[model samples]
Target: MASTRIGRHVKAPRATVYRLLLDADAVARWQVPTGMTSQVHEFDPREGGAFRISLTYDEPTDTGKTTAQTDTFHGRFVRLVPDAQVVEVVEFETDDPAVTGEMTITIDLADADGGTRISAVHDGLPDGVSLEDNELGWRISLGKLAALAETGELP
Candidate 1:
């Protein structure tokens, strides 16, 4: 029942920021937490779309619930409003008792002075995932998002 929200301002237009957020390759590039690499097996960003992603910790010992060194998850895109917001209903591919249940995540964008203000809200965090870790993880992910958006790179 716990939730967390994080926000940042990116030096890019809302459309640019939104596009990067939904692109499969871009997600793989910027959504991973620091020290991890991510791969998007499947992704569809529109409403009712489905996506699957895997995150691997560089260090073997830092394994995750789905498999050694990896954390895999899948979700459905609950809502998508162009240049405005995206919502997803996600769940981890894990058997860990503490990390049960689905999480609702919403990412929103609004006009800033000269760019876009991005805000992400993550709801229903599993007990196994610590709050501090989630906070730091989001910060790192959003930082990458900002950099990628500013560069306007297609990956």
Candidate 2:
């Protein structure tokens, strides 16, 4: 199994960050690429609750066609510490059954000089997955999160 961890400090309060994390609409607003679309199939922010996100990547190709793909993720919240941390167990689903594994994601928040320090750890990642891609996605998502918390707008 592979593991990936990423962290960033955002200029926002812990409570504000936590609220943005729990809000499904807010998640949809910032969880995808700049021009792509994201949909939340199910979301429950509390412990033991389930959540799923469908991300559609729409990019125009040189052949005048649009390359689009949708990835669905299913996960359940394992633990929740209000304004502090959240843990979730997640699984990725694809047509290939072999591409399956469990990932435990931990999001920790703390007070910083300008705002909050956010740390994320994604453990138990599958061997076949690309760590760089995962890290980049998280980086973008976290950047969006910071923007949302600070400006109340999706980046």
Candidate 3:
């Protein structure tokens, strides 16, 4: 029932930003938070397509929702609008009831003065996830996105 929204400006064209949003490799690079690595198990860049991804903590001591060090999730692309928006519904693979739920992530892109403006909304966060942590993760991920879009590199 909880949600978080973030807005960012990237010095890249909307089309470029949108392309990265749907690209598996790009997602693996930019969608992960700091101190984590991402692996794309399966990905289909179309509406109703399914994708599976895992985020693993670099530190061995860190716990994850699904396993000892990894958080795995599977989801479907709910909607896709070229150069505009993308919507996905995802559920974490976990035994813990507190972190079990389907979450919706919507990302919108628009033209900006020098580049593109991105608005991301994440809804239906499970109780196990804290708002501050979620927001911080998003901020880091978005910063990576911007860096990738602008310089073709993750920063």
CA-only RMSD, every prediction: 1.7, 3.5, 0.6
Best by TM-score: 3
Best lDDT goes to which candidate? 3
For model 2, give the 10-residue run with minimal summed lDDT: 59-68
Give the per-residue lDDT digits (tens) of candidate 1, residues 55-121.
Answer: 9999987968799888899999999999999999999999997887899999999999899999999
- Model 1 ranges off by over 4 Å: 153-155
In candidate 2, position 58 carries an lDDT of 64
Task: Please provide, for model 2 over 1-155, each residue's C-alpha lDDT reduced to its tens digit, 9 standing for 90 to 100.
Answer: 88889998888899999998889999898667554578899999899999998777666431111123666788999999999998999887664544477889999999998799999999987776678877888889999999999999865
Task: Give the lDDT ranking, best first.
Answer: 3, 1, 2
Give the distance in Å from residue 132's predicted Cα in candidate 2 to where it truly belongs.
0.5
Residue ranges of candidate 3 with Cα displaced over 4 Å: none
TM-scores of all predicted structures: 0.96, 0.89, 0.98
Better of 1 and 3 by lDDT: 3
